[model samples]
Target: MKAARGSVVSKKGVPWGTIISVVAVVALAAVVVTYYLVQSAPKRALASWAPTADNPDPSLNIPGIVTGQYQASVHILPTERVAYDHSPPYGGPHDGYWAACNGVVYPVAVRTENMVHSLEHGAVWIAYNPDQVSGDALNTLKSKVEGKPYTMMSPYPGLDSAVSLQSWGHQLKVGSATDERIDQFITALRTNQNTYPEVGASCDALGAGAFDPDNPPPFDPTPPGPDAKPMDYQGSAGTQQDTGMPSSAPTS
Candidate 1:
């Protein structure tokens, strides 16, 4: 039988099979393109929020620009444990283990000490108070964090603010998820080799016991005792100058 003119049938006269295969191939390509766009949308949105000023190399000198937006740098002994002054510690002596920062968003609160170790590896920690942030705000924060390499987010049960962003020695807190600084902090610091103590370290393959997302380490939400080490310690116990601590708040 002669095939109709302008029909989809091949010269071999196979009609349905060839057409189906071509449609399937096109559909697969479309799926791939859609996935790429979806994955890249957050990054593209964040790029527009980056600072216009030349950002100093964080790996070179770890500049301490504490004038208005910046915070003071702090380094301390690599202690097995510490009572950090900050709820979600910015930087200080920390446990050897580091929470997995390869884009993991831990549902439960993570240990402050171990997360500090993640900061040392150039991971930005996004912490939020579960009681304060929920609904659309929480989802918005997750979109910015989930699947983003070298970043981690979890609840800080008694967080000083509704949301907090922390790098090696930098921190910024915002009252809401919509705050513009959320994107700016992530853009400025993720894998920023200069600001952290041990840059280029693997955020992955940290100790297996370090962080099991199914069962993350509980945060010590209680206020530090009078003897809790000050966060501004400069690489020595003696140099840890006393500083005011955040008042403890009820956990969500």
Candidate 2:
């Protein structure tokens, strides 16, 4: 009888070991799944922040939304040069040529007029003050701009704010690179047809020669003409200055 009892006890031990092994495998899988979800939390949050059809206009009465008497007309100049009212121009007359908006990260400042052209093509331009942004903050902004079609970023030497985000007819200034509104602006305006002045304009169709991210046109800090018009498209062009626009438009 003792021998029979021993056999039954040994059989019970084998089953218990198998059950433990199964539980261990399941627990490992659950941990891996949890880790991936945690890693993707921020991206998921950004995706969820996107504007829907009913709420397409996120700029309306949105605090920090740039509202002013800026121009909203389109003028194509023979040159890629423009005299803009805003330092990081919202929109107005732009160079006939547009910067390549194919997810380019311009290390140096790009011409404001070329950038405005990109915005007209449904691109979102992000500008930051070099003196104010660096290290992780700068990298975070770069990641947002890099390899994402219809997006471009460049440093503005004399930006009135630490960072400014511009889309056609829209602008937002923020004090930090990690500001929640940064993502909000990108989500609300990036490729939003309702906000575009030229819908279906090809952002990538612009020839590569117009802009080279690695060797972009250096930012010219030359001040705009004394006759520089306010940010109005309907407003007539200011007398062409021999030099580029101002170092930065005075922020209201």
> What TM-scores do the predictions have?
0.62, 0.77
For residue 249, model 1's alpha carbon misses the true position, in angstroms, by 38
Candidate 1 per-residue lDDT, tens place, 1-107, comes to 35575354555575788899999999999999999999999788766544344655332222322211212323333332466655667776664456788888888
Relative to the true structure, candidate 2 reaches a TM of 0.77
Per-model lDDT: 0.67, 0.73
Model 1, runs deviating above 4 Å? 1-54, 57-80, 205-207, 225-252
> Candidate 2, which segments miss by more than 4 Å at Cα?
1-11, 59-63, 67-73, 78-85, 205-218, 227-230, 233-252
Worst 10 residues of 1 by lDDT: 243-252
For model 2, the local distance difference test gives 0.73
RMSD of 1: 10.6
Clashes of 1: 3
Which pairs clash inside model 2?
70-231, 71-231, 71-232, 71-233, 72-233, 73-233, 223-246, 224-245, 224-246
